[model samples]
Target: MRLLGFGLTGLVVLLALISLVLGPAAIGPAESLYALFTDTGTPLTLVMREIRLPRMVLALGIGASLGLSGAAMQGYLRNPLADPGLIGVSASAALGAVLAIQTGIAAHFAFGLPLCALAGAVVGVSLVMLLAGPRGSSLTLILAGIAISSLAAAFTSLVLNLSPNPFAANEIVFWMMGSLSDRSMSHVWLALPLMVVGWALLGSLGRSLDALTLGEDAAEAMGIGLRRVRWQVVLGTAAAVGAATAVAGAIGFVGLVVPHILRPLVGARPGALLWASALGGAAMLLASDVAVRVVLPSGDLKLGVVTALVGAPLFLHLIYRTRREMA
Candidate 1:
């Protein structure tokens, strides 16, 4: 337990240091650290404050939210493989933001996009839960999620196709690809408070999740309120995930992979796993974002694509190993 805690802490600290120091510029760690408090190099200071800080803040915010949300979802459903996007919640949120952008509503109302996305996520997940019934049908939930995701994707496409404005299609495509580049402080502010609220709500679900490991009937026998627990995770997830998708678009893989990777280190307890995943996720996405800056010099690489590159293999490996273990 001590070693696991140390390791997670070390990884998080090291990753944060790397994110704050390393960048596309030639500013070394010494200079960057120096300029952190003292404004030495005007250009480097500007880069750190105006550009990198906002991006880093966003990286931490969105990554942590996704990780915690995934852990919560897995706990709520007691499914190791369950994910928010996999459950159709993320797709619905994305569609909502896209629609807002298409109608030019977001231009006038800064918070409109995220608000719409939040509403869309609520609707999508509501439909999924309704379809799965009160029992939360595991297989049916997955199927319902898939069906809903497909429908949302189709509708988003149809909207783009029907729009007279040509920019809408391209913008929507790029938005879905997910980039953290050139995002303003406004985006950071928009997501941070909401994500904090989500974290608090979801973080409290740890004990409930631990109880849920015994199955709903057993848990209820132990005085656990399963319905309340379910809402805590679901609504909490939607808010955080919606806020994240609103700002950074749809960056995948963090939520799915972070908790699983850290579960052993954090112990098998879902609660411990949840907080650790948030920290680990902040590390992962920040590192990935930094890596994107280093790898491609021509243009800004989409954060989602980078995560997908790493996460797709992990997903495949999980499936293969699961098969082996079962076999």
Candidate 2:
């Protein structure tokens, strides 16, 4: 299964490479490789270097970030449905990005918006934890996440409403919807470090997550300290989701859907599934982003819209499956 996963992941990377090179003014693999490294002055080289590379990197980073974060959440909560978006983490990050754009913070510094989004994620996790409380059940955590998301969303709408500038308001509207067009390498560089750190933290949780399969009490008996695991999950998820949102806005569904799709292929083991999910997620997201470009040749397409179009139905399917299992 692991070998199959690695092979699948490699196939996805190949597809991403094809996507990167097969655009309207497409370049061959050799040319693309040369352009990617040599950084020549030809138009094809420039396009491959400047336009496609950044977008590909953004897709990979955002996908991996969402995928691992979701894996961590599912592992920690002992529920397949527990994802970063459901827990208000992504919403908080989006709210923060929106606030930054509307208030001229992003105008001051290019990286300001993503940084603020990261901050928002931190606050969101803090609030959700507070509301969930120590003895909270899985249901309690989900409810708290919903409550926190609603509150954060309201605050975001309120902030936008109170803004004096109409342009900023319109900008805020687009920012919330989420897209990857016109994103520079600066955005990629801005969020990648934190995402890397977050991935490391999440990946390490695999063994802990496997222990969690036996239930929290059993995990504790096996010396997996529950409190420590909880903090690690929260902090690790916040880092990944927040950083990705800071760069890509609120990209929904990738986190939730990736884990569900790959879990079975990895034999449903947390210890082995974490990195597999990350690679699968990167491939999945890059594929989706490539699809967006192919479908909308006229202009840029919304990243969230593409993911949601694919993700919404997948999420519904998961819910149905969960219900069936419970029944």
Candidate 3:
């Protein structure tokens, strides 16, 4: 497990460093590294500090959060099909971003979209929590999440349909597709605190989740409070995924894909899978981000689109494997 953990961590670090240097600019890796640390007052330094650095940071943080949250959710539910969006936070955040764009708030202010998106996430999670109640079962939680997610998706679609500005509609569509472009350190600061809190909450669930593999009754007998675990899963996912969707627009599948891929590697232990997925997710997103710039330097390619394209095939394979195992 230590070797696997170290390997995944190293992969994440390597991809992040590559992300920093693989932009469209013709800067060499040596020069990029030099500019990243020195205040040389050059354009290269500005690009490194302002553009690449924040994008890299956001990708790392957001990806890790998504991966961790996904593992936590699947562990709590004991279902491989589960992902962070099962709680409606992502849809709610997207609704918030849609409203911002439709109301021209996004056009008028830089942070309006993300702020509103974050607010929507909070509201969505609150609604789910409220509807699920304090001691609701996992089934009830799933139902509540589905209801909230459906409502938010409906509202988001309505906003797009009612939008009078084609340009704004286009912008909303692209934003929903997700990208790491044009993000700054301000965006990082805006999303990081919540991500950290979410990480702490989710990471602490390692022991609880490991116990949970023995079934709820068995886990409780082992002194694991299922209620506490539920709260951590819900709140941690909300904070982590909400903040990520707010800043990066609705990047999907990192949560779904990373945990699924790493599950077998960790001997199907949810506790170990948590951190492994975090590192794998960070590497995945960083590699994807670099690929976009390298493959389509002249055109805009959204990060989420690439993820979805890659994740869909893996998801199909997962389903196949599950069906065979069941058989």
Candidate 4:
């Protein structure tokens, strides 16, 4: 397990470096490395520092958030299908950001957008918990999440539909599709603090999650506070995923895909899976971002779109596997 963890960390670093080197501006690997450290104020330096650096940071940060949160959620809920997006947190965050854009709050206040999205995530999680009941089954929680996601998505569409300016609406639509292109350091700064806080909160629950694997009754008998664990999972996911969506729009499937892929390798232990998922998620997103640049050097291909194309099929396969096991 330690070896695997180190391997994942190394892979993430390698992918991040690759992301730094690849771009339309044609900076070589050596120059990219040099420009990253010493800012010569040249185009290469500016591109590396201002443009690609933040994109890579956001990709790493956001992907880790999704991955960690997803693993934590699946662990806490004891559900294989649990994900940030499937649970409605990402959709609610996106709705909050969309509302901010629609009402011009994001334009007026520097921190208004992410704050609103965070609030929305809190609300979304609260609703899911409330609807799922204090001791609802996994199926009940998933159903509740689906309802919340549908409702939030509908409202987001309505906000876009009612916009007075076509151009503004277009911009909103593009942002909703998700892209790390043209992002600056401000975005990295905005989301990083909240994501770190979220990581800390979630990472603290590893032992508890390991306890949870023995079933709720066994976990509680061992003095694990079930209610507290749920609260931590909800708030942690909200902060990390909310900030992620606020900055990068609604990039999905990282949380879903990374955990499932790494779970078996970690001996299906939720506690150990947390950090592994974080590193895997970062590598996946960085690689995807690099792929985006390579595939459409001059055109636009949203990061969210690329993830969905991959994630949707994997989701179906998971469903099939689950059914087979149940049968």
lDDT of 2 by residue, 158-254 (tens): 9888989999988888787777777787778888888888888888898889999999889989998777777777778878888888888888888
Highest-scoring model, TM-score: 3
**TM-score (all chains, Cα) for each model:** 0.88, 0.90, 0.98, 0.90
- In model 2, state the lDDT of residue 250: 82
Model 4, position 259, has a per-residue lDDT of 94
Each prediction's RMSD over C-alphas, in Å, is 2.7, 2.5, 1.1, 2.5
lDDT of each residue in 52-78, candidate 3, tens digit only: 999999999999998999999999999
Ranking by lDDT: 3, 4, 2, 1
lDDT of 3 at 120: 96
Off by over 4 Å in 4: 107-112, 126-144, 315-327
In angstroms, give how far residue 230 of model 2 lies from its true place: 1.0
Q: After superposition, how far is residue 232 of candidate 3 from its true place, in Å?
A: 0.9
- Cα deviation at 93, candidate 3, in Å, is 0.6
Give a tens-digit lDDT track for model 1, residues 74-114.
87778777776877878998899889989997678968877
Determine the backbone clash count of candidate 4.
0
Positional deviation of 34 in candidate 3, in angstroms? 0.6
Off by over 4 Å in 1: 39-43, 107-112, 122-148
Task: Sort the predicted structures by TM-score, highest score first.
Answer: 3, 4, 2, 1
TM-score of 3: 0.98
